[model samples]
Target: MTSNDLGDFLRAHRARLRPGDVGLASYGRRRVAGLRREEVAVLAGMNTDYYARLEQGREHSPSPQILDAISGALRMDREARDHLYRLAETLPDGHRTQPRETVSPMLSQLLDGYTNTPAFVLNPALDLLAANGLADALFSPFGKAENLARMTFLDPAGRSFYAQWHRAAEAVVSSLRQATGCEPHYPRLHQLVSVLTESSEEFAMLWSSHTVYGKTHAAKELIHPEVGTLSLTYQSFDVRGAPGQQVVIYHAEPGSPSSQALSLLGSLNATRRRESTPER
Candidate 1:
């Protein structure tokens, strides 16, 4: 999409927000709605011309300082600020979009060696790339599914996998919505959302909310059939220069009973896979 698309998104949000939302008084009777560009410029300590250029799609690049000022003026939360940056990067100027690169073969092999722990690589869209044996087993909720978002939001087994499934589900859907606002016309993204909406009522309802969110640190408690309750801590590390890919590692606390249970799960997975391999 063009810079105009980003401009329109900002403008629409600007119009939708009541002056009161930003701590301004709502005066009676005005032709235009919400905070005016001049008001925002005053709040942000920016010149009207520069802010106007940004709003009209005439300006493409701005510094972090500028972004912070405008974001503050708009009363944007963390999620909205992130969306703003994503859109600014989408501008037709020489701004660089982060790259999506393949995970190193060594990393994939290393995950397999974990053998006893559940580990996988996920794209920003929550597509499952490579996962270990136990990871696969824990993911039976997906019934051998490929997309993480779909399994989490659309499947029954998925619902039962997480103790706080609804909360987890909301995060996934909200993240996707944020991604969409950042790249609204992304064809593959559009297809992903379209498929989920058509396949699941739960997804359709959340998608309509137009909510957005940023990912910080998150913890997950999953019920694995073999392991019982696996309380896992997840750390998401950015694969540098790989725009949308992350190295997500999960670990059960050492010396905890859950760790021993995970070992059992790993053993069982290996045995079953070995049996199936020869038979196949």
Candidate 2:
């Protein structure tokens, strides 16, 4: 069992809840902002010392009953509950891991067909395996790293590119955590995690929270250096043949400012390509 991860997850979720939020009276000056450890233990219907031990990484395995109670006490949503169970290695269903990192030709063709959309494929570790022209243009500011997590946490351009930089950082870390949990033996994942943890305090803090999630579908606000701010939505799809690969496509509303900006970006890219081509 991932004892340290389980403990960290419990502590983070516990810290996210407040006494008043859980229908308890907030009396006396509190030392912390969130619910206390004893309060969580009481709500979880377990001994305070036992829960404390669990948080201290001394107790690894808790029964499904205890986990359920803790989930309830922490007010976890469906996704968060699934993540907590994963951290405890108590998930009912097993997940498939990526055996290799190659993007299929069919998937590549599909991405290429989406001429107007910014489409790309990523591995479990958020490494870019394949990208269409629009995506290449969109992510050009990230340089040639080809890894989203590293670019977000390590690259200074990431702060300006993602309008909601903090939200983007948290989501990337959470996604990485989910991926690592699914495939614990990926060496590159470990290396990436180690580097980010050691280099970026923000990444370190978010990693310690033990959040786990995939970027399925979400609205994004991005500030492109040339195109300006764009309000776009994206969908992430799992590649069935490749277990841990995801195909992500970004879209904007028709006739909206975002769509116009995207068109302008495409035009600019075409112009640059033409400029680079040799006259025959």
Q: Could you estimate the TM-score for every candidate?
A: 0.62, 0.65
Task: Give one digit per residue, the lDDT tens place, for model 1 in 191-257.
Answer: 8899999998888998898778966567678887666888888777766545666667778888887
- Per-model CA lDDT versus the true structure: 0.76, 0.86
Candidate 1 minimal-lDDT segment of 10 residues: 90-99
Error of 2 at 76 (Å): 40
Model 1 stretches with alpha carbons more than 4 Å out: 1-102, 182-185
For model 2, what is the C-alpha lDDT against the true structure?
A: 0.86
Query: Highest lDDT among the candidates is held by which one?
Result: 2
Clashing pairs in 2: none
Off by over 4 Å in 2: 1-97
